[model samples]
Target: MPGDVGPLAVDIDGTLTDQNRALDARTLDVLRAWPAPVVVATGKAMPYPVALCEFLGIDSAVIAENGGVVVIEQADFLSVHGNPDAAAAVLADYREAGHDSGWGTVDLINRWRETERAVSRDQPLEPLEAIAADHGLVVVDTGFAYHVKSPDVSKGQGLETIATQMTFALGDTVAIGDSRNDVSMFEAVGTSIAVGNAPESVRAAADYVTEATYADGFLEAIEWVGTTD
Candidate 1:
């Protein structure tokens, strides 16, 4: 069973950080010392997670933009699905219509993204989903933002792709998250853990729910995995 456990794929925002959105130093050290590979799967831009990986000195794969982009071994990034420009155009239309449909900041709005485009979570999803559907795209609510991406692109698919590249079975992977966007990965992996701060729906979907929140919960997950199997 120990051999069956391959890698640990973790969500970044609410799972890895506290109220301040900072990674705990102890958690980073624990991950560095952990025997298994630790992959950062996040809804944030690719650069953010990539930078974090570099800072942590981890060589594992990274799932960024809520699975819109995947970075393997710190090599080139791979776009998972549809064109981001098309999605951006739809959001632009929404903006012209006086709808509050834009990224949180101008910097994020101008940032280079490959396959996924982000809009404010406050925007109505029905209208956005309709627009995305017209362009063969879909909308996923990441709690913090609404992602307009291809229907085929998801955190689950990204993780599965990474697992295949690493020559590990999908059943051997462990996925942990605290948001709706993470549901895909939770369904994709054999083991899923949800932090205490996660929504009820997210917690219900996980195989285990930690008593702690944020970094402490993540550390608990790692320790639980170590003791199991």
Candidate 2:
């Protein structure tokens, strides 16, 4: 029942967007009409959540840069504590490690392209996987871009933080996603749903699968919830 639920935590990438970053009208409706608060949990940067809030007409919580940062309205709750100096230090370590391991440039954005080629070639999977594993980074396969981020920062970690801040009982919230990053959300929410077009691995981790993609998936999940509890 809605009475038991406090807030809704949803992912943004595959759950809401297609090959392009288009918002689904059906899914937007669910989010707009939700009686409880809505939280956008994503691997995107701070700007992403801000843009979504404006688009969705929602003024609520957001988890960005994976789980490293969080904002509710204009207030920041959790943070990755970015400092140019500190970032430089970490980047230096990353570069040396990447170089030693036969990895490419420490430039994350550029390295991602190289990583994709490696995955595509199916040659020396260990090199790519090792870099991520060594740094406790989770490799986010976005089809267009691969993200290697600190293990502690991600959609799942963001969901945990959102749930805690909202005082929402774990068994009362619903989460939706379409990738491995979403597995964390699936594990965190009372209901874990995947879109019909989700990867098999994602489907394997979900409690339910929708018959649509993007906004359609979100709408399906909402409709399912309306009928069930």
Give per-residue CA lDDT, model 1, range 13-50, as digits (tens). Answer: 88888856787776777656646777789877778887
Model 1: what TM-score?
Answer: 0.88
Candidate 1 displacement at residue 114 in angstroms: 1.2
Compared with the true structure, the alpha-carbon lDDT of candidate 1 equals 0.79
| C-alpha lDDT of residue 32 in model 2 | 78
Candidate 2: where are CA atoms >4 Å away?
A: 1-6, 74-76, 81-128, 134-136
Clash count (model 2, backbone only) = 1
| Candidate 2 RMSD computed on C-alpha atoms after optimal superposition onto the true structure | 5.7
lDDT of 2 by residue, 127-215 (tens): 55565555444455644344455554566666676667666676777887776777877887788888876789889998899988766
lDDT of each: 0.79, 0.63
Minimal lDDT window, size 10, model 1: 101-110
lDDT of 1 at 160: 79
